[model samples]
Target: MRNNGAVHGAFRSAAMRFFSPRALAAPYVVWMAAFVVAPIVFVVIYAFTAGDGAFTVGNFAEMGRFVGVFARSFWLALISTAVCLALGYPAAYILARESGRVQRAAVVLIMLPMWMNFLLRTYAWMSILERNGLLNRLLGALGIAPLDIIYTPAAVVIGMVYNFLPFMVLPIYSVIAKIDRSLIEAAADLGAAPRAVFTRVIAPLSLPGVLSGVTMVFVPAVSTFVISKLLGGGKEILLGDLIEMQFRGAAYNPRLGSAISLVMMVIVIVFMYFMNRFGEGEEGVAIL
Candidate 1:
């Protein structure tokens, strides 16, 4: 009976370790609540309230302007994401396939820009793209008229693409590096064309990375104020600018800003949901 009791006690202890709530998780939960959930709750409450003393629907009623801002934000983010994918895929492929030393160098080169302040990077683009900037000087030397690239929508896109490209490439490289060479070789051995192998094997297997990169690029691009302000100028006001305007200006309308913020959050959630659903069934295919 003592032997049986000892065995039962050992099993119980093991089960408790597996099933009991982890102490480590408690800190993370508290942190999330403090930083994320608390702010969101505050935003939600303010969104329902009004600038005036009374509770009102005025903020929600003015949501049309917010919707327009949201649309512009979405389109710019989409364009930036497309550019990141177009540029990052090849760069990631090369980095992943390169030798260890070359890969390390490439990674360092890719991440070097991130060490600089984001605002400084945006300002650098502004300087380069400005009418009397280095680019125009080069153009003049070549007997060409200086083109206006700064303070335009195209410039905004370019700035966003440059800044976020690393975010896209690193995730993709991580996925591609883990892909097995033999799976790719098998596809080739089976008489599959290069295009066929990439589409059927590489594309599907690399999807998780692509999704991660897309989310990383898209979310920040949509909400970024610095790039829009620096590159787009005041002429191209994005949703972030509008939110800032409400908060900082004499309006001081927290309710309206909160409503706009909530709407932006919803849009992000919906976009991610659809993207995940689209990539769901074809996961775990050979990628190398």
Candidate 2:
């Protein structure tokens, strides 16, 4: 009886240890299992299975038909990311050098549009880019011919840059702001020119933030359907729109949609892998 009592005591001790304070992660683990992991599993299953439930690779084979879509999506996304980087780096650098009051005001201005509904902001851009819209109207007032700017790839890229530019700026600014001023001073004391100090000291230190911003801007830009739909006038058929059609439109092929989603996810993962490899030593901030 004493031996049996000791065995029960050991079991109870083990159970108590398992349910200790650190076990607060149980709810989060359960949530991730149910939401993130389970959805990925379902997507994989559906991607490989046909309507009749037989496993097949036909879904992936159909992806060949979307070559142009894949190309266009990546091209537009690349352009948007490039533009954001070009514009954001300068803005972030300048913002980092400003007084705290100026920095706060600038950040507020940058983020103001984001506080509004995303669809509403896109609609506002549509209004501004319309043939007789605000932009053209302003040009007419200046006696310049109204440019053909609306319902084109340019409009789509514009919408993307306007929306995602903040993501690029904030990360780079965070990194640039946190950089050790002593390094810049040291570079200056060593007789490095202002431009040289920036190129050699500041830019290298901020690469991780740049990488983070690139990933953030590129991922959403590649898969955005609403921007292409509203701004491209439904003419620009991207991978996002194609997948959405498969699932929601008359096409109604969830298997194909899942396959496309899986492929896109793989592509993104591979892209991120390369980005991380390029910024290997700076992994701490680069992946985010």
Tell me the lDDT of model 1 at 197. 85
Q: Candidate 2: where are CA atoms >4 Å away?
A: 1-21, 286-288
What's model 1's TM-score? Answer: 0.87
How many clashing pairs per prediction, in order?
A: 0, 0
Top-lDDT structure, candidate number: 2
lDDT tens digits, residues 191-279, model 1? 98988988888877888888888988998899888899989996878988888887898767778889888888998999888877777
**Model 1, which residues run further than 4 Å from truth?**
1-21, 24-27, 52-55, 282-288
**Which candidate comes out best when scored by TM-score?**
2
lDDT of 1 at 279: 73
- Which pairs clash in the backbone of model 1? none
Model 1, global lDDT: 0.87
